[model samples]
Each structure stands twice: as structure tokens, then as C-alpha cells.
Target chain A: MTLVKVYVTYKESILDPQGEAIETAIHGMGHNDINGVRMGKYFEINFTDDAKDIDTEIDTICDKLLANPNMETYRYEIVNAEGAK
Target chain B: MTLVKVYVTYKESILDPQGEAIETAIHGMGHNDINGVRMGKYFEINFTDDAKDIDTEIDTICDKLLANPNMETYRYEIVNAEGAK
Candidate 1:
């Protein structure tokens, strides 16, 4: 089986309010050395050994479903299923 | 500066309805080779060089805010901030 690890995050130009809120909360908790924080989505996808055109499939999936083209960007890594947790 | 990448996910015994729904959608889109999918949270945090006991602080933050200890688990990696995007 193949395992794909995908991360989707807001574009650099976008303002991440949620991340800002978390950063404030963290600061309130006394971690003042933190400079910034960004939050994103993570996904683990497992494919059967018979799956074909896996690379193309992953890109299609990310563009069409996993990320918003206007505000977010995504990247992924493919690895043997056995190597992932 | 320091960069910390954090990944938080549901515990093995937890039911991930969102992931299952996405998997169904993917299959409906003709990606029948997919076996399963799991969804999680990702974070990128930047800290100044003066941050003290970062490992301990990260543990505290994850336990108190980033994850629900009963249902989720988290892991992180630290690297030079300049190396991250």
C-alpha cells in the first residue's frame, strides 16, 4: 500500500485569524518567545497496491478537494505504507 | 530563531467521520483504489532564539491547548527557522 501525507496551509498573503488567536492565547500562557504561529490541515491517505497513477491522482485530489486555490496551498509526500504510523 | 512543526491527530480508537466522508467523496470521484483516509491538524510555530526549555513548553502547549489528551495525540519536530517556508 502507499501512504500519502498532505499538508494544506493558507497562502502567505492571507491573514490567519485562527492562528493569531492561538498565538495570543499562547502568549497569555507565558510563552512570550514565540514569534508566530500558523495552523493548517493534515491528512493521511492510504491506497491499495493496485492503485495506478498515484502521483497524478494525489495532485488532482489536493487541487479539487483538499485545498482552496485562492487562499490555500498544499504539498504532499508519498511513502510506503509500512513506513508510516 | 527556531521553527517547530506540530502534527496532531485522533487516537487510534477514535472515529474520524470527516476522513471517512472525504474518502467516500474521493471514491465517488472515481478514486476507488484509496483504502482509507485520516484527517489531522498541523501547526508551524516560530520562536525567537531566547526561548527557554522549548521542548517542555511545547509539551505543555499541546496538552493544554493543541490536543485533547483523551482522544488525540501529537508529535513535533524542531529545526532552524531559516530552513522553513
Candidate 2:
């Protein structure tokens, strides 16, 4: 099995209320110098096969379904995959 | 400045259509054994100050703003933060 970790985040132009709230809270907690905050998501996946065309497979996944492409940006890295190279 | 990386993801029980689509695409791309996919987000923040009360500040950020506390889960690690200990 191979493990993939994917991270998704809001586009810079998008207003992130959650991030804004966090920034405000942090500043209120005596960290007045904190200027901004942004929030995003993470995913950990396990693949049972280590096929040769892994990158292509992942790319298809990303383009076809994993990301909205308009609202968010995604990046993934291989963490580990036992027996899948 | 100190850097913080935060990740947010859906709870396991939550349905992730994006993840499902990625999984299907991967399986179709000659990796039939691929079973599941989950999607999430990532954030990188630069703090301008190295205040002593960093953890508490961050906790407030998380509890009050960074995470929904209902629909998603969050975790963060410090990657780098010059002059912030």
C-alpha cells in the first residue's frame, strides 16, 4: 500500500472568513502582530497497488474529481506506500 | 516571523465526493486495487511576532475560528518562524 497526502487551500482572492476569524482571535490573545490567517484541508490516502503509471493516475484523479479547480488549489506528496514503491 | 501549517479534513464518516471521484479515476487508470480517496486543505501562515504566548494564541485561533469544530478536523505544525522561538 502507498500513502498519499493531499492538501487543499482557498485561492488568495477568495475571502476566507474562517481564516479571518482565526486571525482576529489570535491577535486578541496577545499576539497582536499576527496579521492574517488562512484555512485549508488535508487528505491521507492508501493505495493498494504500486502500478507503474502512478503519477498519471494521480493526475487524472486531481483533474477529474479531487479539486474544484476554481475555488481551491491542491497539492499532494507521497508519504509512504508499503509494497507499492 | 514564524510559519504555521494547518490542515483541515472531513471526518471519516463524512462523504467526500471529490475523494470518491479521485478514487474512481485512479482505479480506471489501471490501478484497480485503489480503494478510497479523501480530500482536504492546507494553510501556511507567517506570524510577525514571537510572542511568548504562542500556543494559547494558536489554540484560540483553532477553537474560535480556524476549525468548524463540527464539519471538519484540524491539525497544525510549525514549519519555521524566525525570531518566534
Candidate 3:
């Protein structure tokens, strides 16, 4: 089996209110050095033995569902469990 | 400034309905090789110059808000924008 980790984040043009809220809370907690914060979604996917061309499969998965191309950007890394060196 | 990327995911014991829905959709799209999927929260934090002991700060931040101790697990990596190579 292989595990693919995908990170999806708001596009640079999108405003992130949740992140702003977090930043405010951090400041109130005395973390005065913090400049800003942004938030997004993450996913961990496991591929069984039947999967082939994992990269292409993930690209399709991201484009089709994992991320909204209009408002978000995504990147992924695959961890081959069998090759856990 | 430096950027810290944080990923907070549901603990193995937690059931992820959102991920299950995605997996079902993927299967509908014909990618039956996918076994399981899990969802999580992602954050990008920027640290201004006054910040020190980033690891400790992040540990506090994650423990304080980024994650739910009872249900989520978090990990982070620091990216030094100034040292980009």
C-alpha cells in the first residue's frame, strides 16, 4: 500500500477569515511576534494494490474532487509503505 | 519572516466522514483502487522578526488551538523564505 498526502490551500487572492481569527487569538495569548496566518484542508489517502500510475491518479483525484481549481491550489507527496527506508 | 506549515489530522481512532465521501466519489469516477481516505486541517503561519523559539511557539499554538487533543494530531515544518534555495 501507498499513502498519498495532499495539501489544499486557498488561492493567494482569497481572504481567510478563520486564519485572521486565529491570528487575533494568538496575539491575545501574547504571541506578539506572529505576523499572519492562513488555513486550508489536508487529506491522507491510502491506495491499495490495484492502483497504478499513482501520480496521475492523484492528479485526477485532486482536479476532480479534492480541490476546487477556481479557489484553491494543491500539492501532494506519496509515501510508499513498502519502501519505508 | 519565516513560514511554518502545520498539518492537523484526525487521530486514527476518529472516523472521517468527509474523507469517506470523497473516497466514494472517487470510486464512482472509476478509481476503485483507493482503499481509504482521511481529512485534516492545514495552516500556514508567518513569523515576524520578534519571534523566538519557534518550535516551542508552534508547540504551544498547536496545543492551544490548532488541534483538539482528544481527536486530532498535528505536525509542522518551518520554511525560511529568506533562505530559499
Question: Which residue runs does candidate 1 get wrong by more than 4 Å?
Answer: none
Return the candidate ranking by TM-score, descending.
1, 3, 2
- CA lDDT scores, all candidates in order: 0.93, 0.69, 0.89
Q: Model 3: chain B TM-score vs. truth?
A: 0.90
User: lDDT tens digits, residues B11-31, model 3?
Assistant: 888988998998899999999
Angstrom error of the Cα, residue B13, model 2: value is: 6.3
Determine which window of 10 residues in candidate 3 chain B has minimal summed lDDT: B76-85
Q: Each predicted complex: what DockQ?
A: 0.93, 0.51, 0.85
Tens-place lDDT per residue, model 3, A1-85, is 7888899988889988999999999998899888889999998888987777999999999998989999999999898877321
Residue B78 lDDT, candidate 3, scale 0-100: 95
Could you give me the TM-score of model 1 versus the true structure?
0.96
Candidate 2 lDDT over residue span A1-85, tens digit each: 7877777677778888877876776677666757567777676767666455656766766666666688878777876566233
**TM-score of every candidate relative to the true structure:** 0.96, 0.68, 0.91
The reply for model 2, stretches above 4 Å from the true place, is A10-18, A21-31, A68-72, A82-85, B10-31, B68-72, B82-85
Task: Point to the candidate with the largest TM-score.
Answer: 1
